[model samples]
Target: MNKDSAQTALLWIVAAGFFMQSLDTTIVNTALPSIANSLHVAPLAMQPIIIAYTLTMAMLTPASGWLADRFGTRRVYFVAILIFVLGSICCASAHTLGQLVIARVLQGVGGSMLLPIGRLAVLRSVSGEQYVSALAFISVAGQLGPIAGPTLGGWFVQDMTWHWIFLINVPIGAVGLYAVRRFLPTHGETQAPPFDFVGCGLLSLCMIAFSLSIEAPFSTHRAAWAAGLFVLAVVSALAYIPYARRRRNPLFKLALFSEPNFSVGLIGNLVCRIGSSAVPFLVPLLLQLQLGYSPLHSGLMMLPAALAGTVAKRWIAPLIRRYGYDTFLLVNTLIVGSSIVAFALITRGTPLAIEIAILAVFGAANSMQFAAMNSVTLKDLSHEDAGSGNSLFSMVQMLAIGLGVSIGGGLVNLFSAQWGSAALGFRFSFACVGVITLVSAWIFRQLDVAPAQPKVRAPATHSAGR
Candidate 1:
């Protein structure tokens, strides 16, 4: 093919990879109840399915860049598609929750590389002038995944079977594999720096320990295991400090924290997302299990939130410019938190219009919150630190998502058992998570009030394996 044709084909290839990855990130949420039934597990007990995939992605994301550089992008991308396809087949074939969780982990292993490597491929191939537009084009595919995932999952679960939620990826992955081999350029491997495997392990351990601790409430020996894991998490986190400091090329430089906004924004992102991330996981269950909505209806209800979030993205820059990061994040965080809390009031008696409005308002505020948080966190990073800082930020974002689901599911399980009502449990879970989000407002308050500079990079939106 000609140069222009090759580049265009490359874009299509990468976009397809992105669509597959992003689609899987959300496609399983609406199918959880069905899958739980199939696997003979409680619906609330299914958080591990989501947690396994997200946490695996979180743990492996930092390695994706290194792997791409060590191996050629085309080779790695091809392998990634192959593994993802295999994982999807395994998921469809799973008869037990254990088998499904293992399959999801395999899927996460591939997903963890897809977007990062795909973006890297585009960066190498596309001209600098066209880079932003190319990314914007790819991002549309990412956005469409979340928008289409739930409804598609619902339709499959209702009309066919929950297995199709995963089976659907087989055709997409087949096409992606063909495209990768045929269209993607062999960029050839470059010698990369020694990866900070130890540092990465420590951080990954910290995240895993913490997540497992949250999940321990469901275990028979909850207290002892939870305490031990929580302590392990804290110790693992502390161990990384001196370890990173001594290394010539650490996983992430501690100096990145010197930027006031970076520190505040990172903390706020972690804390705030712990609440908001649970909404996607919890809302579907709330609609179907508690409110008696069908799978399709539950999935359809998510449309308002997703659409509102898309529309609200355009408003983020203007609002931040007007109010400054400190003011914008503080106020927007409250709105987001309030919106999450308001879900507690949702019930069969609640008007459909009122529920839709709540979803829309939450969607807008949460979208702005992510954009503003991401921009402020990375805005001040020096050129030298930008890449590492961004990688660490992405890892934390995925970690937060896993934690949110773990905590949300744990809370519901705990509360339902105690309160003897699943409905009350869902309400209490919303309230708890909402309060967690509200606490982040204090973190955002620490940002010095200054005129908001235009974002140096696009706000990191949720993608499959970001």
Candidate 2:
């Protein structure tokens, strides 16, 4: 193929890889109840299935770039697709929650590699001028996954079974595998650097400890033990900072946070996403368990949010340009947080129009919030630090998603016990998460208003991080 056509094919191949990974993230959210039912577990207890995938991704992400460099990108990409498909099959066949969580971890092992390696491939092949368009094109593909995942999952669960939700990945993954072989160019493997096994272990332990701490209230752990675990988590996480500074080549350089925007944006992204991320998981549960919406209908309700987010992309640049990042993020963060809280207002008697409006507003604002946050975080990175910086950002994003599910689930159970009402529990969880989101505004407010450059769109990498 000619260079242009070949590059186009390469973008699609990477996009397809992204689509598969992205679809799995949301697709499972809608099917959580059904899967829980089939496994004879409580629907509320299904957070591990989601947490396992994200937490594993976060833990393993730092290794992906190194893996691509050690093993050629094409080879690693191919294996990633293969392993993800196999994990999907295992998930479909799972008879217990434990088995499914194990399978998801395996799936995450592959997914953690797919996009980073594929992006690496694109970076090596494409010229600088073409990079923006290429990334934009791939990002649009990533958006399609969120758009399709919930509805497709609901349809699969309703028409067939929850197993199909996983089985669906098989064919897509197989196609991706073949496309990688055919269209993807092979790259020379670089001299392998010494892997930071110690640093990675510390960070992984930190994430697990913190995540389990939030989840402890739901489990049999005592409050004191939970508090202790949280303390341990903080210690382990803090230990990594000092370790990174001492090491010659740490997994992530401590210096990356020196930029004001990077520091503010990363902190803001994590806090903001804790609330936003929980919404997807919570909404399905609210609609199905509380409002008595069918799985298909509940999934369909998500369409407005996805569609509005897509349509709102154009408005982001203009909005940011007019108000600047500081002003835009501060105001939009409130809108996003408020939109989340408004979901508590939805009841059996609530108007459908109001519900859709709430979701749509949150969708648009949240999308803008993400693109702006991502751009600002990476905007100040020097080209040399770009890869590591982006990888670190993506890792934190995944960590936040896992934390969001854990916190949201734990809150629901905590409230359910305290209030003696499941409906009240869901409502309280929404309000609590909304408040958490609002707190992130202070982080955004720290951004300088002068350098308030607008990001037209975020790359597939950041959007995929969502």
Candidate 3:
């Protein structure tokens, strides 16, 4: 057909991939209890399932730009779909916790490239006039996927098995694969640079050590091991900073951070996200472990939050326009933090409806926080900076998510040890995390109050990453 039509179809394909990735990230939260029960692991121990996906994403995300430039977007997109589909099959077949974690790593390997490469493809092919709108459309679809994922995952798990939540990806992935192969534009150029093996290795090691350190308390309860990991992480990171600075072509350009707004927004995102992302992973475990709620019941309880988050998106932009990003993020961060505390207080006697209401409010604030933060982060970045900056932000987002779940889980274990009550541990953890979220208000306070210009939105890649 026409080139314009092909471009439109191209975005649709990428949007499908986005939806699949988002759905996978969120859907599993509700299904975690069943998966843990089936595999005979502690429900609290299931944080790895979430960590594996996000950490893999964090580790691999920076590589996508290079891969896409070297391999051509069409070829990479095809491989991405194949890897993702294979990952889904592996996940469905997993019979043990280790197997599932391994399978998630594979899935993440595929997913890590999908959004960034796809966005790069669009940015390369689409005219500037059509660019943001295309990105916005894909983003909305991706956001809506999470809005529906928990409810649908719960339904599938309750009616069939936890396996089906992943198996469902096969069909959606099939559609995505076909669409990418048929509709996506081919890249005519090749990137001539060789990959940076040393830098990649050091960076990967740093992320792995940091994420695992967060979970160390839960597994070994050895503060010494955790302390060692912290030191290792510091070394690995310090090595990368100077190495990246010295390199002619680093894995990520150090220049991206020189943009004051983007740099600050990136750090703000990581901090803000750790607080919000921790809740999804924590709430499921709290419901089933502390309150002894059934998997189906807990999933049902989370539905309101997802629903409210969706409805809140429409209002987020207007709110941003009214108060500006600084005020919006500062205020919204408090609301999100408080919601985590509310969930922390949950127990068997907690009113089901009231609990749902609190979660619903939490979801809305979280959505608004994302929309605002993402906008401000990218607001100053231009087309040239888009690739590395977005990729860098995406990496931090995943890294934060991994840290959030791991750290949050570790806190749960700590409180459990001190309080001698699973319920009390969750409450204290929630309050602590809540206070952490509130402190982030200080992060946004640094932003200047520039009134946002309301405009039509398009295909920005939305990540379920923190």
By lDDT, the best candidate is 1
Poorly placed runs, candidate 1 (over 4 Å): 218-221, 456-466
Instruction: Say which candidate scores most in TM-score.
Output: 1
lDDT of each residue in 174-229, candidate 2, tens digit only: 88888888989989799989889889899899889988888886776589888988
Q: For residues 155-203, could you state the per-residue lDDT of candidate 1 as single tens digits?
A: 9999999999999999999989988989899989899999999999999
Measured by C-alpha RMSD in angstroms, how accurate is candidate 1?
Answer: 1.5
- Model 1 collision count: 0
Which candidate do you rate higher for TM-score, 2 or 3?
A: 2
* Per-residue accuracy of model 3 over 1-466 as CA lDDT, tens digit each: 8997998898888888888888888889988878888999877788888888888887787788778888898899889888988998999999898998999999999998888888889989899998878877877767767777877888888889999899989998888878877788889558558878788888888888877676776679888998899789889988998999888877777778777877777778778778787888888778877777777777777778777877887897787789777777888988998888788767778787789889999988887777777777767767877766766677777888887887787788888888888778888888877777777788878775487774323223336312
**Model 1 residue 278 CA deviation in Å:** 0.8
Task: Decide which is better by TM-score, 1 or 2.
Answer: 1
C-alpha lDDT of residue 107 in model 3: 95
- Displacement of residue 101 (Cα, Å) in model 1 is 0.6
Q: For each candidate in turn, give its C-alpha RMSD to the true structure in angstroms.
A: 1.5, 1.5, 2.4
